[model samples]
Target: MSPRPFDHVVGKNLTSVKFPVVAGLPGPEGLKTHLRGHLLRMSNVGALRVLVTGATGYIGGRLVPRLLEAGHQVRVLVRDPAKIRSVPWADGVEIARGDLTDAASLREPFRDIDVVYYLVHSMNSDGDFEEAERRSAENVASAARDAAVGRIVYLGGLHEHSDRLSTHLRSRTQVGEILIDSGVPTMVLQAGVVIGAGSASFEMIRHLTNRLPVMTTPRWVNNHIQPIAVGDVLHYLAAAATAATSESRTYDIGGPDVLRYGEMMQIYAEVAGLARRRILVLPVLTPKLAGMWIGLVTPVPLSIGRALIESLSTDAVAYEHDIDAIIAAPSGGLTPYRDAVALALRNAENTEAGWDGAAADPLPTDPAWTGEIVYTESRDAVVRADPQRVWEALLHWSSRHGHWTVENKQEPTLLELHGPGRARLQWRIESVTPARTRLHQHASYIPKGLPGQLYWLGLKPLHRIGLRRAMQSVIKESEGRR
Candidate 1:
């Protein structure tokens, strides 16, 4: 069979357009004509002034870079602008502070925006999240319509239409319907489990597989699901920004492979290089019971776990492939499930590395007049070595020392080293005896403002753990040297 035309190459810029030979027209001339038509359609669409909600979320955070690469003028609507300060594309795009539930805050951000990507959802919120989501969607749709926004693209869950729809899936579908009914040209791309680093579903899978070698799951494990890569989802989302489509369209999107939940776990185990896990499916475990178990084993909260577990009871395979005729398939074709898992794992590793590196970097030195010290943590250890030996150990304890705490991986900052009795900058040492040295460590931060205080309090636990680890490492190294 002939390969499909315009297969997308994964992990590259979207500029690579290919045209294959058609059956009816004459050879190269036919291909050239088709290519010209495709280019003309693309030109007619042009670049859009796009507004993205939920810019700090896993999918939205990643999507911003892709939209920027495609040369679109991007504006991000975020509740807190500081949340996106570290984002790589934060500086390149316009940012407006707004909340979807607050209709007053939405109008300014939606003004003159050609396309609005409605990515916000209240899945993790406490109490009546479904109602909250509906209200927020209503506000967004109304705001976009009032501002004359051309289109709205939404990401929703894939589920078969039925009265027994889970609350999560029901809310997703309802939000899409609300947007469509609001008279905006809305495109809803429905997907099942999104396999990507930092995605809630993928994280749950990762933790469950990594932590449990012997698993006993409910009957939902047998339900069929099609997990799509976050990359492909992003591709479709970016394409929807300009792809010609019906006024209000709903597309079910998934990866090439469909597997049962149990099969997905097995594949994840394989990709993660874990030993083959044994599974026992019991028919009696309720969603609440399963959620409690998941909450106990994984970092996911009970609310989210229950919601996700409820949705897993139904099959989520796509019923249509019409999206391919509109938006081109990924360059290298759709990512296989295993390949998607692998990519997610690689991204996770890179993210962890970045986090560790950030933790190890020196903290900003605040001037004394900034404010009063808002946070301080201290630790002390006595080493059975001379002062000189302890000093030497301190001098050499860089990030490579690997003695930092398991949680934050924080390395000490040396501010001062005077003779054998004094060392400073979060650490100080004094020789109590010729063969015994007393080491004291303290992390002190003066509040630059309210944000500084919040930052210090937020990381207090990690800071404490890091201080303890630093003192212990110094003691061990000094004692060994003696």
Candidate 2:
């Protein structure tokens, strides 16, 4: 939660900044003219009152801090404010409770807002998400029109328009069209495969690479993708707000390098310092089967895996470079694909703990207290070191000769360690920040028969104390290493 290095970029004089123009686009003089006009438009408006939807989502969660640092008055609309309560920037902005499907709830949040960032989507919702997305977009467009919002900025999937378009891509395209036609100037930045820590795509890649030394593939793995770094995407989203444009426009945003999905996995492995994985590209594996396999092997849900697999069947490379003419590249220009992976890995390594809040009860519902009695005990600690350090410390604990056993002998039967994924007994290191790590230790057991139940009850107090002390030991050891 400490101040980010990019805080200086906010509230700075835009006119003094120099933006790079892509080849075949405007030259330096033309770039100067465009900047003059853009700055003039920005000056006339002064500071903008921005309302951000999907503030609980990955991109929206990161975007809020950037907007606030840029000196904009920010407000967030969410169906459940508790979802964002633990965010480092939560206390700095206005919070309004509302759902996109309910148009009535949108009025107050939309009021007095100059720009609206529509980051909401129904990809993970139950039932038909496509229909849900359509309804949500229509409601948002209507509400934006009613609120007299000057502009709307949206991030959507990058894909070619075709009868064969995947449902997820089609839904994203439909939402963009709806926003554009709302009579409010809307800027849509279409991108594919945003690489960053805590992102679904990145997490899938991380888990798959770390756990599997070999992987079976689908034919879609050969399809080309132009993955953009989350940092670059954030840069574009933040800059689009100030670009001088009178009409709605769509820009294709991507990184400098284009590679196939399989190549992406290889590069990630290389960056993460894992051994090169052997991948067999089997044409027989259908998207459905691939999704099921991904779900079973990694933490990614089948639905999300299917969507990602479907999108990988088509090329997502950008055909336009107009975004460069508008917003300048970051200080070092667009991050290369390998560099982006390395940065994401670095972020993962430095990830802090405590951001996930508390672990959910692992037991299933037992209304009548019949059948086997199940119980779970969890201990969480925030360590000063990064997740990588915490993970290494835990690995050391697990590898000790007879540490986790009773009496330090008899084959160490006290507890077992399992996972890099969703194993029953596991220690997970989740990233909260660049310098902090959250260590979550969990143990679950189901007692069968009366004797087993009595045994668990008898040892419950000791179990609690042992788990808490173990977590404290981890924290102390990790801090010492730091």
Candidate 3:
């Protein structure tokens, strides 16, 4: 770590940001108003050159855009840059090809970077994951120091110091220590279960509460937890990159409320309009059994779910709020647990990421089971005609002048319609060859409440038949055309 600690965490030589203390407004929300307003008013917007790892991940995916929004020049390092090519913000940042476990691959990405966001630590890595993470951390620490990177910001799991810490939390703590001691200033933010759409924690709670009105067993659900929203995490991360700071230390970050894991699940049900759930904790249910149960209920893979479930066995409440000294709470104080859940619910249906400032929309990489609950029926066919012909046929068949109107379009390739009471129909024209085109038609209905649920149940069979006929008609029309 740097002498007297803290590089203001951005560049070799940089002036620390100074903000006017907000007063008289009262409470935490008032205190939060100063930092953001001051930063935006700065003459130097987008001054820092930042590099981010894990660009495709849930948190990193959301943070990159915020950094860009702050007027900072951002670069991302990924093994396959193509993974992020379809993202709306893909073209806005520089891309560096690299692998974390391989030290040599990080050199170019770390070069001339003002701050390095070490956002990745994966259990999915081949062989021993602990060793893999240790190697990855060592590689990042060495590369950043060699490049004289101003600071390294890492996100770690929040847990108390104990001999009984789960393997997941222990590995995270080790990685944080390695970066802090790398002789480069580092800010390790240890956060509890992250609450957001597509986040594993949120999805785990979502499926469990949504599917099982009455859950059988895990005593871990009674453990205390202090989960934070993804938005707040991103806020602190984006701020930490440029804020005046001097510690190669760990900061515990979490939401305002401290509730039991089961209480958190019930809160989720409240926010989502679901009935209050009944949780029956069975002390005899082992972690392995709990993991298998979660696997059966949720889309999160067994490997990840197992680790997450194991960590839940310990209380995860934050030990301190020392981070407020460096970066203020996100605009309106820290997000309360209930509001965070509500925001995540809103994010579930938001196709555009961050259209709402606090919305952490689900990413393409999120499990297919995550996001808005929509009943869908789709059909596709290969027609002996060009895309234009198929598209014409698609448009003709989709037409219902009084009931449907185009929602979005992309020439002869895609057409989406919105109408007939929240139902969405879309067509895609793909050119398989000069004379052959693949036409796909999809119908999706997003149900709102009990009535919406019953509506789908009643109309599902009719929907399947109608969708099949619609695609057949389009394919026949296009194929029969000259």
Candidate 4:
């Protein structure tokens, strides 16, 4: 661990400066804000202007908000400014229109920027995502070198400590090399499945576990991985901007638990309070057939589904336990996969609960119910503002004082956090008009016998009523906000 550079933000040589302890702040958010101020003060004195690329992507989207909150004047490199308008702080960011493939466009974004966060990847992109990712890395590295950027922060994938790497993971490693070869100090953080809302991997797990009752288990499901929370990943990214002494080094970032995907599904089921399905695994299942099965069952696209499923055979846990030396020190304690999933679901649920009004009613309940034991929740709020304003509140509502509750097998106490309506089990959100928001309740409990099925069937109508009442409460709350 490195010393907290209380004054290093002002351009004092970090190696020589003695760090002072920071005064007490409320929490991580507060500490980040203070750090941002420190960094800005340094920038004013000619330290380094920072540039964040891939602002439109998932991790990048979350990272930008933290950066802006920290008081860093961030310039986000994006291909289309319009794609960013829906972003919460769209107006706040200094949007630089530059695609990685276009070298001419990269010059403006790299110009005079002290630190650049290289976050773009093509694994999710259409055919030849690997080649595209490599090319993009090359273009950015060349432009950054030409512009004399001091350091580059990159996030890549973690794989087994072997020469045989999955195409996806291999390209990620290559991308780091391209940036390092460009003469800039580069700190690479390699991570496995990032567990959180809107994360492709997490969502896949969520949908799969929730929708399947009896699944033809793939051998990949038995493979082990150390999953990290999205929040943790962000902390590392922020810390990496200034933590590393060696610019050309890599760090292995993972969660506290090394869990099998099968175990993960069982945890999810338990936490969500759904009945644990009996999983039957067959060793004969090939990655190709398994991927097609996933495509048939889960919402994951065929391309990524194929790539990810194939990589499961290779252990993605920490490679050399010593890689932490390069990346920034770990911030708070690591969140478990079950807890992370609960938080993510709650975040998404809370957001969904905010979309109330006439037009959004009866909101696509079955839009995508391909998962097992599907827990579909909808809530609506009718505010004086149009759909846009209601949607805004939904998207950015969680960070504030109002907390959302999600059950976790590891932490049963979280169930109490949902309040009385949630005791019934299930979530709902509805909006009759722009001015009204509704929270819906839809709960399905564990089945024990004929009595259990009868009891659940009998209560099905009541669940609908409960859902409507929950929606009503949400609407009232939204109204109170004004």
Best by lDDT: 3
Q: The CA-based lDDT of model 1 is what?
A: 0.72
Which numbered prediction scores highest in TM-score against the true structure? 3
Least well predicted 10-residue stretch by lDDT in candidate 2: 358-367
Write candidate 2's Cα lDDT for 1-482 as tens digits: 22221123335654564444334335555544533443344445556778999887777877887898888889999888887676778888999999998989999888877788999765563688888888989888877766656678999988875677877888899999988876566899999888766566666676677657788988877888899888898888887766665457788999999898888888988886667878888999988798889888766777777777777778888988887766778778888989877766552311123332211111111112211124678777778987666666665666662434321111211234532221235466777888887777777654432344466689899968876776776787777743
TM-score of each: 0.68, 0.67, 0.77, 0.68
Please give the lDDT score at residue 124 for candidate 1: 68
Stronger candidate by lDDT (2 vs 3): 3
Ranked by TM-score, top first: 3, 1, 4, 2
Give the alpha carbon lDDT tens digit for every residue of 1-482 in model 1.
Answer: 11112222222333343333323335545434433443333334456679999887667877787889888889999888987777667789999999988999998999877789988876664788888899999999878766656678999999987888888899999999998876556899999998866667776787677667898999999999999998899899989887765357689999999999999999988986677878899999987799889989766777778888988989999989888888889899998999888876653222112322221111112112111223556677777888778767776664444433223222332323221111123556678888987887765554332344466679778867866776777788888942
Residue 422 Cα positional deviation in candidate 1, in Å, after optimal superposition: 36
Q: At residue 327, give the lDDT of candidate 1.
A: 84
RMSD of candidate 4 to the truth, in angstroms, is 12.8
Q: What global local distance difference test value does model 4 have?
A: 0.63
**Model 3 — TM-score against the truth?**
0.77
Q: What is the lDDT of residue 241 in candidate 3?
A: 83
Clashes of 3: 3
TM-score for candidate 1, please give it: 0.68
Off by over 4 Å in 1: 1-46, 347-481
